[model samples]
Target: MVSLIRAIRDHTDEISCCAFSQSALVTGSADKTLRVYSTADFKEFPFSPLTGHGYGVHRCCFSSCGSYLLSCSTDGSIIVWSSETGELLSAVEHPGRSPLRVCALAPDSCLLLAGACDGTVALWDFPSKTLRRCAAASEASIVACSFSPCSQVFVTGCTHGDLKLWDDHISLLLAQKDAHDLGVTCCSFAPHFKIEDSCVELRLASCGQDSLLKIWIVSQREGTAWTMMLLHILTGQTAPVLSCAFSADGELVVSGSVDKSVTVYDANLGTLLHILKQHDRYVTAVALSPAFGLMATGSMDRSVNVWKIGDGYEETEAESQQAPCQGRKLPGHSRLLLADWTEEDVQSWLCEEGLDELVMIFKTNNIDGSEVNHMSKETVAELGIESVGLRGRLLRKIEALKAEQSGSEAPDEFLCPITRELMKDPVIAADGYSYERESIESWIRGKNKTSPMTNLPLRTTLLTPNRSLKMAITRWKSSQ
Candidate 1:
């Protein structure tokens, strides 16, 4: 479940863009200023409301390392600021003096790319703040731009429904005409890549006025321009998707739409997971945090909502190095591998699950832990249990047991109260208790509104990874 943690109404005008770094978040608005906030508490930066742009700021971006923030405005200039102090660092006036629509920073922090309303694409040496080249590459307004992970290639989308690929030298490589039906609004490259044989495989997401969200597979060989193939077309938004971005791990994707809604999708499955309807007007921009379970969505309603995302994929270090037959003990449980459990242990588990009558059936089949762990409904019925409800209850209890077996003989301080297991990727929640990442996420997903330890009301569901505690646990395990 996704919960809104905070709604910021700091912008006096409609928000134009919002971006998140590891420690800070920045939002640009038509009010001619940008606001910065500390990620720790979502507090405004001391030097926020960065004032210098003479006109409305249309787009903003943070460098890969979060040291510098860049914003382009109708004033025909790109202004750079120190993210830490909000001091004006440098500025670049557009060569054509055209209003910039979108901008992107290369992942390697070597270059900057900005697209203009006059169809010009400008490349600059970001470190030195020097203009490299400015070329008129399209007949229509350039609305979207993104750079490949390798920084050797980039893509730009225009109002004519064209998506063009380019090399670092401002040379056009490939052009896909009418990629979107109406116009392109936004595009983003997934931050991670894989090496397959001689080519690198990457994923990119783009949304447009066509009311469609697209996932594309981009492939590039050594010293070659990237080639793309359409992979998935996500269609959960009824209106045009104005903004889209992939999570840092590339496992999830999120988008905001003109429908006044935000949608999160499982990128790998192409499945829609949640629809958030908090904005009264069009949601214009969306950004996802790289480490923390945080998301920022900016809307035309003049607000930015910070949300807490539920994560279920975090794995603990202990689990990865677990032995098949590792020995440990829980307060009221045994930490034995399912494959090693005897028929007697299985019977005891059935009794604990309130399935005393099924003990005879399981005993007849010699169903040990291994067999029960792999049982399907069909297999359960084959055991002469004709009750459909009974089969479901048995299966659900097995899943609960799987969620419980954290590790054996772990310290009490390292165990999550809800799961009664050693912490795996521990995170601290609003109640100031550290828990296994997936355990608390599952707790919040089940609609529990109170702390598991204190039973008091939970002020927020935001979970920050407990790095210090995690390091201590790792060191203790190493000495064991």
Candidate 2:
């Protein structure tokens, strides 16, 4: 059973979109503003209520690494913001003169696709900061869009009950299928999973006003062609299904509907697992935290509910025991823990004195201590540690304790600002910060040449490898 942990009554109007990241929860609203809440305290950011959209904000998304946020509004603009500071970074003008309804970021974070009210899909290249292509995806307005885990393919849902597949780079149509009886409301791509033979299979989930959820198996055929086959059609919602999401491990699917209920399903077999009737009004958005087994739902009742799906919601032991080992594997992120530490150790560490809030933030955002150590100073402050001196002291103490218990700590300067991880390959950005080579390069190429840490305009795109930092990290790892 999933129990509601808390209800956040922050929005004054209907919540239209909600996105989760390692640090925060962001929601777009018919109130025409975006509200940001700390994952730890569920307290609104000091800089909450980001405003600029002249109309309702329709969608909100976080970049793959959680350093940036993208939001589309009915005013025909897509605004990018620094996730850490809640400051507006840039606004991309909509290609068509119609309200934008849906948008998606590629897994690589290098490409962006936006579906507008005029039935046009616009493709943008982050590196060049230019609109590369725009094409009509349907005769009717688009409702939902998602990119596959591999970032090679994307799917778009239209108001005409059509689902279209497109190639990632060229925005070329690969296939189209009439998917729903009424307008399709939401679509999501399952996380990548491997088969017994080490082959990968791509799956897509979609929901619609017809009150049904459909799963499709996507595969590439020989000679540059693709195929989609219906795998399952789930039914139970008494009203229109508004949103759907696949668990990070691709083992489950969750959907929210106008019936004021949230439903969880076994992704592989389409078996009904649980129905949570907690909302009083239509549920507009639903999100799952793969790392924490937490789910969030936003509703037209002007409330957001957070639920904990811990051991109480797990499948029966007999069921799991009957499954193959390969079939039972979880996502890598969910399994990450400190070396030589048990689950109890993690829980104890999280409950340590004065660290309760930090722990909640970590769990809600699906982050851990290791990742927190790499966060930029600005991000650390935004997490509720306001004082710079206090923040520095806390970080140092945490590092010392980790070192005393685990092993040598990576030098703070050796961490990447964008990924909040120890730099595997350090590179110096124009802003003078040392970041992981690939992370910084991706940010530069995918986020319109802006610095992730400083949020300043980059003087140049060229990045110089930081050999000294790389050597230092290598030495630290070797000593450990």
* Best model number under lDDT: 1
lDDT of 2 by residue, 272-369 (tens): 99888756589999987656666788887767777666553344332232222211111111213345344333333444323444545555566554
Cα lDDT of candidate 1 equals 0.81
- Inter-residue clash pairs, candidate 1: none
Model 1, 1-480: lDDT tens digits are: 676655677875678899988899999987789999987777898899899986667889898889999998765689989999999999988786766778888999899889976788999998897899999988777889999888988999987778888999999888878888798889888988889778888788999999999998888788987688899999999999999998888988999999989999999889999998867589999999878878899887778877777762232332222211122111114436666788877876675455767878988999987897788888888898988888899988888776666444456677665544568699999999998999788767645555655445589999999999899889878866
Number of clashes found in candidate 1: 0
Off by over 4 Å in 1: 222-225, 312-480
- Give the residue spans of candidate 2 off by over 4 A: 170-173, 193-200, 222-224, 311-480
